[model samples]
Target: MNKHIADTKNNDVIRPTQAEAEAAVKTLLLWLGEDTSREGLIETPKRVAKAYKELFSGYQQSPEEELGTVFEEVAGYKDMVLIKDISFFSHCEHHMVPIIGKAHVGYLPNGSVVGLSKIARVVDMFAHRLQTQESMTAQIAHSIQNILKPLGVAVLIEAEHMCMAMRGIRKQGSTTLTTTFTDAFETDIANQVRFMTMLRSGS
Candidate 1:
């Protein structure tokens, strides 16, 4: 990318505030052939704008900060910190439809560990975005690995993409599973096997 273009992209990458969000919603309403000024629709744009802010608030958050608060209390436990079945909802950018699913996350801490809830928050952050499950999986795993610098990191996402089910071919049974792994989870069989088995059993 060109220097100026890269800078522009970085600056524009931040979350849009109410006014911008409202404008986008208004545009959508117009495209749908509705008068946003009508009684019921009058505040609909504003509501949508506010909802988008909350839904995509991940852009305003710092994954590093969320994971930075660590605990030294786990002591000698060498096992992976597994948090399974975290329910999440997001929009697919391709069709801007809801993608709902559960995320199974695990990490092997090396002397330090973060709050268990923060892992879920990290998952929510990226999931709130309009994303492909593949990027969502890798982003969560990479974020955890980068912040915790754990012995290993694994993330799996299983989701129903509404873009496919509600439109296009409209296949009801379609679901996507995406995963990402690092360190021993990536190169070591026993570690990967254990993690996968644990995830399968929903432990």
Candidate 2:
């Protein structure tokens, strides 16, 4: 485990314990007119608490640790390395509903490259948190740029917010796209175009 992970665990001391979390769930169920003592609902609070533990597991992870290992031997190959169509599931901070999406990440390595799976793990770390798509996109790009120290970083996310689909105007089949670019990807139009082109090519 990384220092950051350990620090996070230490900080978790202030958060609710499993019993408290379950109690809160039961309170919510009772507020919604559900019988907490009913056979079917008796264990619902515990189940919900367990589910929330998984849903927010990202909080237990550290992006710095995930991207800590970097390989400097790239055989002098320097261009753009991109991974596209990386799927993710997140929840809206306000509504706590699902935000299903795919992330396309690219970076220009500066004599160092990280493992491909690290990029995906970075995406997962941020997605598991409750935040808006735009915020998540920027967080992913910044984490790469900061940890990998690449010449540039790019992140694009396309997601459908269930909050919109399940309520509040009830728009289905609607997708939200958010993108973040840093360094060369932000200043160089050609770099941006190349990243976008590769993302569209799906190859």
Candidate 3:
């Protein structure tokens, strides 16, 4: 665990115990007029609490630490290294509904390169939290740029928010796209076009 994550205000707040979390679920079930003593519902609260722990495990992780290791012996290969079509699942902070998406991460190495899988793990770390797609996109870009000190970083995410699809308006199949660029990518328009071209052409 990173010291930064350990010292955050979120960690400073006393967290509810598992039993307490299950109790809250039971309360919600009661509010929904469900009979707690019924066999099908008896273990639902416990199961829900367990499920939530896994679903939101991102809060327990540190993206900085995950992207910390870098290989300096990349034979001086300092071009855009992109990992595309990396699937992810997240929950919307507002409605707690699922956000199914694919994240495309790219970075220009500054002499060294981080492990390819590390980039995907960083995406998973953020996706396991309740998020807005826009915020998650920036977080991924900044984490790579700040930790790797890359020449530039670019993140593009295309997601379907279940909050809109399953509830309000109930329109399905609509997707949201978000992007963030930093350093060279932000300052140079040609780099942006190259990135998008590579993405679209699947090169």
Candidate 4:
């Protein structure tokens, strides 16, 4: 593994260039005891580089930019904004395999609201990257909170990480749940309960 991956931390995520990615692929191909120069596999490095570019495309985008455009008129609505069972697929930073799951997001509007589809878009935007579920939850909540500036924001992700199930402990049935809450959602029980009840009601 490249040592550079260990010391780099840019917060949003690191996106390596095409040559860098191809070099990593070549390194792996050689370590696998395969002739990377064979005609059949000659272009594997380039294809894998392209695939990674697509897989981790989330790093290239800003969640704030995605959520920047919002609506001020919400029909004078005042209630918990809940979007549940929003499906997501992400690559684990460790193993780079898929973490397939659903996310439940809730927020209390502070006189402004975002498009419903934008919520799912935000989830997808963050998920299509190399991440820990912990960071994924935090990024989603923080991004929404930063962009919409909602009164409160809460996010929960229930997922199955292939890194754990298909490797490590090999426990297939176990699921990881990660939650992140901000402001009223963090300090107020009533607000937290409201979000939890909505999550339960949907389930």
Candidate 5:
């Protein structure tokens, strides 16, 4: 799990009640000049509260535990295992708007391998939270490196943030790219090039 995320769990904080959360949504609607009493908006707060539970559920997940079960029975296979273009939806921590993206994750196994879906699940555990592309990339890479103890981990994420697309300058299609490399990938330029080559080849 990421350090910032883990800190929140260890810290003393009072979480708001569901009704309070709904009330906050109602306040936002009112601020937007939408009458909560109107038929169209009457149930929106409740619906939003429910939707938020699912959207930000990553706080309740443990990435370490998700990658805990690994298989060491590979037939002497030691090579790069890459999963590319895994789609994810996250909200920017700054503006609370959608940051839609895909992640490319790769790692060199030491002597074992994790289930392929587990890699996707790890991505979700980080994505289903308020994040920045840079921080999220580092978080995913660190979690795999720490838990799986792989020879190296690489995470590349490209995202279009709604905060940029829907507001400010309103550049709708601009994308942000962030990458993190650990262990062997960090030390070896050739490994880094290989990861990027593999990623570009597939695209």
Candidate 6:
């Protein structure tokens, strides 16, 4: 099992109850000049609260726990293991708007390998929270490195931020790309080229 990081600051804080959260949502609707008492809008606050719970559920999960089960029965298989095109939806921490994207993750296994679905779960776990693309990319890479202790790890994220497309200097169809490489993937040119080639070939 992987060692879990202790989040003392967050754990020590008390969060508001569901009713209080729903009330806050109502406040937002009122601030937006929407009448919350209307039949159509009356239940919106509760619905929004429930939706938020699902959107930010990453706070309640442990990535280490998700990647805890590892299989070491590989019959001398040792090479880059890549999982690409993992679609995810996250909210920008600054604007609270959607950051939609896909991630490509690869790692060179040292000895053991984790279940493939767990890799996607790790990506989803981080995506279910308020995040910056850069931080989220690093978080995914670091968590996998910490848990699997692989020879190398690479994470690439290409995303469209609603903060840019829906507000501010709106540039529709613009996308952001971020990458993080560790160990061999960072130092070896051949490994980098191979990873890039593999990604492009699939597209």
Provide the global lDDT of candidate 3 against the true structure: 0.92
TM-score of each: 0.89, 0.94, 0.95, 0.86, 0.94, 0.93
Among residues 3 or more apart in sequence or in different chains, the pairs in candidate 6 whose N, CA or C atoms overlap within 3 Å are none
Model 1 TM-score is 0.89
RMSD of each: 4.3, 4.2, 4.0, 4.1, 4.6, 5.3
What is the lDDT of every predicted structure here?
Answer: 0.85, 0.91, 0.92, 0.87, 0.92, 0.92
Stretches of model 5 off by over 4 angstroms after superposition? 1-11
**Candidate 5 lDDT, tens digit per residue, 1-203?**
21222235545655777787788999999999988999999999999999998999898789977898999999999989999999999999999999999999999999999999999999999999899899999999999999999999999999999999999989999999999999999999899999999999973
lDDT of 4 by residue, 137-178 (tens): 999999898888888999999999998888888888679999
lDDT of 6 by residue, 2-102 (tens): 33444543877567777877889999999999989999999998999999989999988888899999889888789999999999999999999999999
User: Which residue pairs show collisions in model 5?
Assistant: none
lDDT of 1: 0.85
Error of 3 at 64 (Å): 2.0
Angstrom error at residue 202, model 2: 3.1
Which digits, one per residue and each the tens of the lDDT, describe model 1 over residues 1-203? 11222223247554455576677888989999998888999899888877876887776677887787988888688788899999999888888899999999989999988888999999988887788888889999998998888999988899999888999998987889888989989999898888889988865
Give the poorly placed runs of model 3, Cα more than 4 Å off.
1-9
Q: Model 1, poorest ten-residue lDDT window? A: 1-10
What would the per-residue lDDT of candidate 3 be over residues 1-203, giving only the tens digit for each residue?
21222325275756767777788999999999989999999999999999998999898898878987899999879799999999999999999999999999989999999999999999999999999999999999998988899999999999999999999899999999999999999999999999999999998
lDDT of model 1, residue 149: 89
